[model samples]
Target: MVVIAVFKSSRPEGKSAMKWFGAAQQRGTVMALTALQVVICTVWLTTASPTPYKNSQYITSKIVYECAIGSVAGFSMLLGYIGLLAAVSFLLAFLARNLPDNFNEAKF
Candidate 1:
């Protein structure tokens, strides 16, 4: 009888721990994705122009072209970051829904 009671009590605790662990993992993933997005954006913006040039006389023209390309790349990276954030939010919601009732009984 004592063993049965102990098992029943521990089950709820275990479920609670699992829920918290899932939440933490999801949050960490989101942070990592955000960091990666920033790094990608920085790299795209700082990379030199890929176009071959004849001489240094066209340095100004090259700068303008590279700036335009960088702008487009930055915008694309921004969109990707937003999409990743939305995906992470959806995953968190799904995890919350699937968590046991005992875990949801109290507000975190």
Candidate 2:
């Protein structure tokens, strides 16, 4: 909404640059997150195993196994990714903390 509103109005000094910067930032963040998620999911799914069930029974043998999460490496990867995201978010927040609430894009 902010970007749309800014673009809809008459041109103003720095408005074009700020809006473009914000849009680029948003796109980059989304693409990075999406790529990370894809890599994580691919890694996790590739490492997954079929669900285990008790028995030597015929019924158990008939059960079809599906992908299930169970791997130390996958968990570690997820944790590392989460930590990285947290660290980045924290850094951005800290940097923006001093900015005023209104028109705070300057710091960003």
Best by lDDT: 2
TM-score of candidate 1 on Cα atoms, chains taken together: 0.41
Clashing pairs in 1: none
Per-residue lDDT of candidate 1, residues 50-105 (tens digit): 34434545674554323234356666777787887789667756655644565555
Residue lDDT tens for model 2, 1-108:
334335444456544655544677878877989798788968876777335644445565566544444776887788788888889778766665554467555664
Instruction: Provide the TM-score for each candidate, comma-separated.
Output: 0.41, 0.51
| Candidate 2 Cα lDDT to native | 0.65
Q: How many residue pairs in model 1 have overlapping backbones? A: 0
The candidate that achieves the highest TM-score relative to the unseen native structure: 2
Q: Which ten residues in a row have the lowest lDDT in candidate 2?
A: 1-10
Model 1: C-alpha RMSD to truth? 10.9
